[model samples]
Target: MGTIDFDGLAAALAVHGLIPRGGIDFAKGETAPPGPSGASARAVLLVGHAGSSIWPHFQAWRATQPAGLADPLDAWSRQVIGAVAVRFGARAVSPSDQPWLPFQAWAMRAEGLRPSPLGLLMHPVWGLWHAFRGALLFDNALERPRNPDSLHHPCDACIGKPCLKACPVAAHAGGGFDYPACLGHVRSPSGSACASGGCLDRRACPVGTEYRYEPAQQAFHMAAFASPSIASAPTSGG
Candidate 1:
């Protein structure tokens, strides 16, 4: 058979809502990850659309989950990207993996992405509506992904700073993320707005309006944010 077509591979995966976020050529970057895969030529990051492209399929699949399936979102993402990695003879990784890599740094270098007011990586076309699901290490080197259309950091240009003001409890204001406050509000009856529509802070960003996730997708994230078990989950980055 012909050599594996990485571009075609990317295009095919995109159909399933798994898109390439960025890639690094270990042979070329000034800095490299420890234990650089001698078996692989490059590392590529993949992002899953939690509330937009991924919603329809995820909902359909989640409907079939038996009662005991814990962390269905993570499980489903691993299964999907894991299958893709296997098909291409590559290694797959999850965002929640131990010994976490700096995904935010990778995204910034790969696509010139910048952080929003709340520190989530902001995409010119996606704002805060997107998330990093997983990544892959390929046995072959691939082309560097394109920079997002707008080189300017949208947040820098925004005068309103609505994201900082939208939270009911000011969870994201005053230079720190008040996680306990956010969780408390989300779990309370007052969190109905965030529960149904997604984070008011995230939704306030005006950029990438067309790329916003659907309400169904938003609800899923809100539910997760509201989960008590997640209070202890470690998160330096997404």
Candidate 2:
């Protein structure tokens, strides 16, 4: 029940390549994220990064950890974000947690985002280059941050929708993702381009081209998407 020094918190997160994407107040009729002690969170602030902002930070942390760590990104996210939450007297939760938190819904509400052809929330500026890694849940309502962009959804104005065509297997065609097809392609010999450079469909998006993730970052995510069971493996110590 104290005013949040949100700016200070943002600065702290930035050191670890995280940004405060936005927030929602439960008092405003928004669904609350599960809070500590079985209570409902009064407010939730999303923590994430745009483009390859977190890549270097991630790589640096990865270097310090034991080899072959499972779900290194998730571990790093929980480690960094959880510490920030504790420092701010808040509870931190991740997208990978059990019972599945509503991160996508929370993201759309917080940033006024719409889904893209690739199923990731499309940002006018970051396009498909951003992600919500975790969230900070507070006991008191916090003011919602204003979205800087006012333009309607970017996909509405897209003429070619090249993202639909860039995939060789057309895994994203027909308004649905062919997860099995996508996984097959990424693991096969023909998947080298996607395996090394990232998803062709995602890279084809003209929006937020400047913020596109580097190949290493892209490859990392693609690996995770292709082999999800890796996440369940025991994580190496940080």
Candidate 3:
């Protein structure tokens, strides 16, 4: 019932390297994410970063935390985004939360994104270098449904499909991701390029080459993905 200045909210979040990716309004015949009070929200705004936009901010914050913090990136996202939600009377939720919210689906709908050969949502400009950190669920519809008309999916026209060929293990062959093969390769002695330089398949995507994550960022994500204790591939696209 209360009004929100969506642009103003975006500006506030940008100060901390968070961008408003997109959103869905239940009033427009779409389902919404759960609100803070456990009720269905009226609208949900996807929050994320493109490329290494949040790297510096995250590093600064990480420096202040205790050493060996588990899931520091997720912790930082929750904290920074949660503060903004409080100011706007909205509820902030993460992709890692229980009953995992449909973040990938929400992102595709909100941004007119399509999955690339690598299985990550591909942006026309950012490619697979972007990711959803969290979402803000509001009690009221904030805007009209987004029009995906002008948003183009880049994969269809890419003739070479270098991303599919880049992997040494052909983990993306046959239109499906070979999770075990990919994981094993990343953890192997011969997988130094991927372990230290990020997933070769992802880096091979020609689009958004400018947005490719820096070496340190790529290494950090690779380390997480290679960790024995990690149950799954990192959801973060960095």
Candidate 4:
């Protein structure tokens, strides 16, 4: 097999506007366990935009499609992850399945860093606004070290904690978010606000406040949330 040029792959992804600001690392099973499980060598994360503009595009796409198709977003996600895997000789996985904890652990170990408010040690630039679109694991080793440390968490100094208080249902209070309650509210027949727009609480997060989803995007995602597939899928952090 030809040598994998990680720097080149990173540059290509950036050019395509998939990755915002994150780094690459060797998981080594410390963070992503199962001892590599015969997977690829590198992982790539596509953190979605946390602003209003993302909605219109989503709505337009969904409107043109037939019902019960795999979530369009999942298809888009696969294209991105596949591109990275093909370019870097790696394998990919979805965050909806693996979640962020293991990846965060691997990143911290690889980079020798900790979490920041705006940029967690594991994921920088996205703060909580970021969600992993997918990851790529490679079978070959590269020469890059862990990313450098960042010392800022925008939420560190945020007063009022708007994200905690913005929930109309009080779902995010007391350091624990009430999922069933929040989901219930969103899915409730009376909750037209979610269908019309999106979650008030998530938009209220002071950190990355600029990244709120546009109304159309909000509707699209809300539609997905209300879909039986997503509603029945296992839950994760908000």
What TM-score, over all chains together, does every model reach? 0.86, 0.91, 0.94, 0.71
TM-score of 4: 0.71
Tens digits of lDDT, candidate 3, 93-204 = 9888877678877777777787888879889998888988988998877766574734777999999999999999999976999989989998899899999999998998
| Per-model lDDT | 0.71, 0.83, 0.85, 0.54
Candidate 4 root-mean-square deviation in Å: 4.7
Clashing pairs in 3: none
Ranked candidates (lDDT, high to low): 3, 2, 1, 4
What is the TM-score ranking, best to worst?
3, 2, 1, 4
The best candidate by TM-score is: 3
Which 10 residues in a row give candidate 3 its minimum summed lDDT?
229-238
The better-scoring model by TM-score among 1 and 3 is 3
Query: What does candidate 2's lDDT look like per residue over 1-238, in tens digits?
Result: 6788888899999998889987877775556666654577888888999888888998999999999888899899999999998888899998877767888877777778888877778888888888888899988878655554334689999999999999999999978989789889999999999988998998999999999989888888778877757443211111
Better of 2 and 4 by TM-score: 2
The CA lDDT at 203 in model 2 is: 90
Q: Model 1, range 22-138, lDDT digits (tens) per residue?
A: 666555654443322454345565555633777676778889999757788888888888888777766777777766666667667767777888888887677776777777766
Error of 2 at 161 (Å): 0.5
Prediction RMSDs, each to the true structure:
3.2, 3.9, 1.8, 4.7
